[model samples]
Target chain A: GDTSSAPASDAATSSVPPGHAGDHNSVKYYKGIVPAKDLKVWREEGTGNGKLAHYKPATKVDYYKIGTTPTPAQIAGWTIAVPPSGENLPAGSGTAAKGEAIYSTNCAMCHGGFGEGKNNYPQLVGGIGSLGTPSPEKTVGSYWPYATTVWDYINRAMPFYAPHTLKPDEVYSLTAYILNMNGITKSSWVADAKSVPLVKMPNRNSFNWKDPRPVTHNSACMKNCVSPSSIKITSNAATMNLTPRLTGPVDHMKNGK
Target chain B: GATMIAASARAASPAPTAPPADNSWSNSLGAPVDARPYGQPSKYESSVVRRYIPWLSPTRLADASFTPLQDQPGIITSNGLFFERYHSGVPTVDPKEFRLMVSGRVKKPLLLTLDQIMRYPSVSRIHFIECPANGATEWPAAQLNSLQLTHGMIGCAEWTGVLLKTILDEAGIHPDSRWVLPTGSDGAHMDRSLPMVKCLDDCILAWGQNGEALRPEQGYPLRLVVPGWQGNVNVKWLRQLQVGREPWITREETSEYSELLGDGKSLGFTWVMDAKSVITFPCPEKPLTQGPGFYEIRGLAWSGRGKVKYVDVSLDGGVNFQRAKLDNPILDKCMTRFTLPYWWDGKPALIQSRVTDDTGYVQPTIVQKHKFWGHDPVYENNSIQTWQILASGEVNNVQLS
Candidate 1:
């Protein structure tokens, strides 16, 4: 039923096969997609193999004719991302000593005073050697490979509720404060565009770049796949009663009610 | 009555042409067509809607909702009932002042307005977008009882837009460009670094979904669609695309998304979601109403790698299995609906489904997943799902050791 991969030689298969929904034609719903009468004409175009009937591949055209060249002023306003190499890292400097006050006033409610995490929010510090243990605590100090990401994240989406409100100096101070709390840096260490990108974290080399996927090769074993004696019921969600009940479609006067 | 019948049957037999006693709908005039300028679903289908848990996130703005997969009949999810995931809620952008900027590592930096973007050659394709953390809650055990809660983070729809290749070609990419950083216009300014090959392959700057303008939650005026990748990388409320030489280790990619291995070293950039499937009909929410009779067991199977080649349904745990029939329009990287004819025998049974993608990769079991990646990695939980069917015809979520 893959129209794009269908052989061109199978031109005889021009009509919609039985048991096939009309929407399967890729046009979907002749009511508004295509007029009811034009449906027959669409199928006659030899595109009835399930590909989008209206699609046409791109062709040659004049370049730089439609959109205008973006001015430097406009580009400066929108460019906000800081890459790994810290190429576009912003200017300004701050120290953990200066950021201690900022952390309590802005970030400590959800992120915690010692950066150990509060409630359900993510913990920003510690968990350096917990990755190999059974209970891995993946935090900024333990997991993240680069420290510039700390500054970037703080600058872009910190304070949770009021993001993009922190100034560049405040972001640098917060990054330094988090680093100091994680024991990666001292409270007196200054952080800036030049200094933040150069700071080496413990987990700098703790990443696998190559992706060797299709890790599990499972066969469709049909009969006696596992010993019946080895089968065990690990958990049952019905007994927990954690699922929320709401009245809506498919109520059936049961648990959904 | 017999005398009246005899009087009516003058030439032959009398005709029974009277209307049914209770034709309530047709007994009165119907509502006018313009009653609802923009129509909504019938009130009877109120329960077939998207839902979210209150405790899923810290705030309501940064939350996720699950689509009622059990109620969705086919591969395509209706626009209104589609799953919703937001980082900073939805922002209403004025189309008159919107512009998509293309800069960094490009020969010509261009700023295209909505009208200019719509003028390009457009192609509409059907694809499935799935959150990598779909089954994260159930990793430790079966915590969610409903299919909507377990597998509701995914939705498939027909998307219409111009290919990123078209836009890149217009701007003329630099020879040294290898990675692209796409940033959003939301409060968090969600950004992700992607390889150039994926961008040039099937990425689309989409503005339309399922035949009309995209909903505000799904990114109204414009969004980015990286086919067959994690939903996070498909930046919504797209604002800019910056071509660069190296990957930008952003917060979303580093502090999150990456998989932490058992050995302490994590696997970064694990984007493609492997083959996964779930039995939607006989799940916790949708139980077998009729007792011990012929029924159709239906489910959904898909892969980020490619089309689903086969889906096998097991009615008795993992002891035995039967090949399920794959429905039509199994397009590449799209959701495939599968069904199996089943007859319940009034006995306790364990129902499950397994999928094999076009790349000959079978859906792994939870045990097998833990063997390689360990149980700590929270993302990418695409393992075989088991549902216990009781003798009373109730289905419950369960885990097998």
Candidate 2:
């Protein structure tokens, strides 16, 4: 029944293939065919074979190997990303007093004066034990795992209307202000790249990189496993029907009648 | 002036007096602010706003916005009025720093800048960009009220860009390559893998919308415009393109946009949107008020696969149908307007429109569509929309029993 592959005739082979290529004949075919060259003679010579056959010994293949390396200043301008572990922290300092001024002028309208947040704009502080509860409202103090994430997020996109408008010192000050409000930093202390990364967040140990438990079953259910009864039953009839009976309410029954 | 007199004299003679009146917008305004560097929609047409149904999607900041389908008259929808859908929100990317990298199965890996993309031979096309879940209504319960529900999240714009086939050809795609993965530069870094055949067929790296540079929301520097396909595939803020033998199965394809069937199986890549049409005027919000004279019933019809061939309007619901006249220049994968003149008797009537595409696919009924897709994620829900006008001139969305 499956006899689709039949040998093409000489006429068909000389013409063109099917589908998109065949529609445009000029695109489908080559003018002439060349015979394969014998490789035995080439292999006998020391000039051909091994890596030397494809490439020369003195030739440089890579761009960096040809002495066309990028300058350090160029790399520093683009690759300024600092990690959460304080691995590539730069020398800078900012005080909580300066941070409060920056937050009030730039962020107060959307994020509230005290970073309490209005409407659905997100609360920046509080909600200390809300995680893993009925309705979790994750804030800087309660849910964020790393202080560096706070710094990175503020530096990258913040102030709502105009993102990346703040200076480096302003971003540092704002980070200190938000951290101080969350009770993570002292009111009088200033925050730097060195100090900010070491200040352990309250929920730093709350999260895990990977979940061990399976979110859903992987294998296909066949044979006995495919039965309706084989499906996981979470509750029974007795538990489903158990309700508090209204025995003492005669007035309610008379109204229904 | 001489042509106007000759046309009027010929019309008076009544020798098969020109093909019926076009009844389009008269005294059409020319392109104002022509000398300005950028262009925008007319000042008089500023009331159109992208709406949101509060009950369906609760959050204001996080939820989707609907295009004002009822308010828009012409075939084109300006770039600003286009609907927006975001996951982790729109990322503010600096155009100067933006770079598009093409890697993976290619002879030459290219890192092209925005300036280089603009230098390529660009082609402009007037096409419709629609979200797969455009008409997501709670059918069988209560039909939605406005045209915003019937046909929102869809817009037509003149997109100017380089054909994606040109870029792939330049890169010299390997023989083993089958899929092209496009990654976004948003905070979520959203990505999707599409068949290489679709890319080669017709895809664009658009930079201009409505004859001007793209808006920030519509991907200012560059965005993939996959015409007639779902909106998500037109990845905004495009950053990377990776050629691979197999699909990447990103979060968008696997978790979010995939549709779940009745049997608990999922349809992963339902790309092409079927034929769909919607009656814009005399809908629930507009109502029928002009008494008994000749009034024009106009609306838009389009297909994802090809150009719309015919649109039939039924006054008495689906009982009787009449062919509506289609406007000129019915472009492929673009919105086409259809109109019919009708005289009302100041009585109750149920109105509906059906679209037929060049691919010979007809718009299915609500019941028929429900039977096939079984609606969980509500993507590609294209069905015949009905508007019922009461004797008292009260209009509402209704379904025939």
Candidate 3:
């Protein structure tokens, strides 16, 4: 099944899988993934060792005719994800001044008028160098590594109440306005694909990742793992008492009523 | 104990005029099988349902509800009770109208219907899907003081669907196709580009959860099941899988999810969720009562990379630990329930559970995890949670240094 690793060669050996040859003329593996008509043809006319001795060859491979090739137009419509590179940037541009109006009309309610963020909503401006501090202010300008992410997010999921409602140019304007709020961009700057990716957000390189991690590790210690006397309570939560414990009358008490 | 003096007759039953009356159909025939048609959890379980942190998001329309892990009985999370995190709202899609499009750098780009998808030979495997953000608030010791609040962002279910490779094979994956972008049909169009290696490995295009059709919140009709990956990568209501060469580095993977360290350097392709575990019992919700005599400290342990190797329980912080008995049938990538029965004599106690997966990566202490990822970005904080149980039988979520 791991056909990717082994390149098919012209000098076929007994060990080579039925369809793993590198060339197009090789016994390519369908693995039962063909269309209904194609599968029918394969069952009848295919000359490969599919029709084996005594065994139903079709039973070995599992394939389904579940999906179809989407039209180019459909992919264009659905694949709206904008990466950090700002590739596939739409044809539109807007200035920070234009973005200010769009931001107030659409995003101001939840994100705050000036992108200060209200309540738990994310603040879009300020906190330029706060990421390294004990208390970080992660905003569009301060912590976002890529400026295109802001534009992509607004185009996709912003306006909290109405997602994907903003037009491309509106999203650009809003991106510009938010970047300007963070001082990542000038008020006169226009945000298009080329300019948005260059906003150079602060704390852009603050995220750390290592896969297959125990980037920090702990072995299974059966006893005396650490000095019990050395254990210290760094934080106390009893005084805060933020957890909501809603208590009500019990309706069921195992009585036969 | 004070002796009970006989109270007034009215105090007994408010001037009991009628003693027997009737049974009031208490013994009547139970309601017919179709009396209520579909089934639901009993009304008494009203409080056992999911709860969301109201401060996390503005409305339930685009927010996550923590699984009631503390209240849950076993490893199989109920379909209705499964934890759901939705960036956009849950979309109402007709299976007949749904078409999964597979295109880009493939020989046979295909758009398959849901019926056609079911035609493929299906495989059922139980895997735990965890949001890396599990126990995020406790990373900096915020006040979300419950197991449901701390560790409820994960749930395991027996997911049934066709292997992602089965479909990719049908599409004739080109050698150039290094990454596959599976996009959600929700309004947000949430999409995550999974590396081709992971797609070909063990991912599934799942439509069934816990032996039934997926609940709407759980991405009904279809969703991608990237076992051991972040919950966001499992795009629900999957609409398309475009095979390509480069990772899209979408918003879900970039602007969010990626961990921001104290040093201001972020990691982008941190795909596989690390090993983690938590003690569900004696949590803030299940405070130790009655002197905690012979309490079986039970909890769930799991890792994205593989099976949970062993879980250890520490009675006095992390100073010492004892091997906890893991319940039978610890499947790979599924939650393993671990229990350690210990006798207690009503003393102040600090309890913690540590996990190690089959990969031999031991679950780190809170201090150890923070050492790697300092502060601010609060995703994947799967550190050992220490619960301080006071002599008064009240439990508090505490961090030990």
Candidate 4:
């Protein structure tokens, strides 16, 4: 690094080596420089009574005190999320036998008649114990850890076209039917708030929640990283013929695909 | 005969200073302001538009349209050209009728209209939102030929909104609450359980994009902008926030977003995007048209953890690396532009760009990524991409062993 020794009293536009007078490398740029170690970050306690420390607000006045309190009816209408505990599930029950008719009409079009999946739509059942295989099929039976997810999803987004139209009983019935198709429950078993939570999914304890990241710490190996002869071209996308035609700048351009 | 000879003489040796005849636009008057209340790009720029493969999704309603990364320049993606990933069709949300309900494990549950949300002290920050499955199709092989198709599942923009912490503070979050389930009001009513720590951090309830009201396709009324996190958790058409003790284990978190492994186990809650960079210019669509001359290679690099510290350009397929100049205004968790001056020799070269974030994590190679995570886990494919430039200045997507 070149040291800047230009006189402070000189003209501001001094033509010096390594840096111009106005740029960062100039001597004047370091006139009021502060040491990096002295700078410290401090956060104020968040407005919420929670213990987490948050960034200090720019102003002292409370800006979020504008909204009005929601009424009991409003709260009940919007609070629809159901956790794995099933404590928030609505009062409803359905049998897998009764859910069979609902599945064929509503879900069978996309999720397949037996939850095997159709087209690009998600498969809901089967593929149990197939995660270790070469090609694992991650259906609801083999992947979902909780049965409440099935109920919540169906109640919230289902029928492929008409979502949030299913009654609580219909959602429960669909959940039961999907579970029965996966061989997790009997057709006669009743699926209520109580029995649904207790129904153990085959892959309930399958997930590793803690994110183990930075899995590959590849360094910048710049020199002769790999042998030229050993480097093989494993695949080429141009030969695949999967690229879609578009009206973009490359509409007329061809890469000899 | 004299006139014909003069015409032939002019055609054979035209004066270099003479202008061409096709200057119609220069001679004519441009359109007036009244012509378009809302401005649009030039007619010639119609080629620069978002596109999608029809077969990618089951239906058009629940699909994704990729951004034209090749055509885009700089960091900020235009509001109209930003990538769109909708679970169902875009719902027509009336701002006057929109109400965001904050309930579940809160002391005073509040119902806030769009106007009330805008009243809070607003802060705008630019950040990139990317789908977890950005390069999922190219894991085993480079399935998409164009850069837009391969790496267009991301868009960076300046989002304006109130801090979610401020709203949650007013609601008075319960001490036991660990998760906040954000539910969209779209046809799907898409819901996802976001960890409470993330909500309190940089998450904002964004209502504006690129200095304008949010587009209907981008959740006109309100949308949660979880910076650096996966796009799926940033629920658009945000209508409700339910603070809870446990994660709701929604469909997205389970069978959809979770990464399945070959050992009969899956990794859940993998939110943050790793360091990644890709060269936009000299890509498949924008190849080396100006053959064998001084060319400035341009690209975009970003990370979820922090700012990109530096980017390295490799002209010889990772054989050698040289630091590319990173453009200024490098903010945290935002796209950073990088450029490298090069003289192409018109030879076959494997061009690649590698990014190292502030955390000192170098972007992994495709082989390195597959070695640890295998060919599955169809998300978080931030591996270094290779564009094979042939002798004829044509580029192709290829995977190297």
Score each candidate by Cα lDDT: 0.78, 0.62, 0.73, 0.78
Fraction of true contacts retained by every candidate, in order, equals: 0.61, 0.00, 0.52, 0.64
In candidate 2, stretches whose alpha carbon ends up further than 4 angstroms from where it belongs are A1-257, B1-46, B58-61
Poorest lDDT segment (10 consecutive residues) of candidate 3 chain A: A1-10
Residues B170-242 of candidate 1: C-alpha lDDT, one tens digit per residue: 7766544556788888787889887776777788999999988977777778889888898889888888988
Which candidate number has the best TM-score?
A: 4
Give per-residue CA lDDT, model 2, range A86-190, as digits (tens): 333345678779999988888877788888986556678887665445344557666554565566567645665555456778878988888888877777766
> CA shift at B12, candidate 4, in angstroms?
16
lDDT of 3: 0.73
Lowest summed lDDT window (length 10), candidate 3 chain B: B1-10
- In candidate 4, the second chain superimposes onto the true chain B with a TM-score of 0.95
Name the candidate, 1 or 4, with the larger TM-score value: 4
For model 2, residues B9-73, the per-residue Cα lDDT tens digits are 77886444465343234346644675666665566655556665544442344456667777778
Q: lDDT per residue, candidate 4, B1-401, as tens digits?
A: 99999898779766434586446676789889899999999988988888876657777798888899998889999998998898889899989999999888777777889988998878999999999989888988988888988899999999999988878777776555556889999988888877677787889999999889988878887999999998888899989998765566688888888888767778877889999999998898888987898899999999999999989999988888889999988988899999999899988889899999999999999999987787877998999999999888889999999
Instruction: Give one digit per residue, the lDDT tens place, for model 1 in A5-117.
Output: 11323222324321121101132311221223333432332222223233332433236389888888777667777654455656688999879899999999988999988
Please write out the lDDT profile of model 3 over residues B100-153, one tens digit for every residue.
888765777777899988988789999999988888878876456678877889
**What TM-score results for chain B when candidate 3 is compared with the true chain B?**
0.92
Superposed Cα deviation of residue B72, candidate 4 (Å): 0.9
Error of 4 at B143 (Å): 1.1
TM-score of each model's B chain?
0.95, 0.87, 0.92, 0.95
Q: Stretches of candidate 3 above 4 Å error?
A: A1-65, A193-212, A246-257, B1-29
What is each candidate's DockQ, to 2 decimals? 0.24, 0.02, 0.24, 0.25
From the highest TM-score down, the ranking of the candidates is 4, 1, 3, 2
Worst window of 10 by summed lDDT in candidate 1 chain B: B13-22
Residue A155 of model 3 has an lDDT of 88
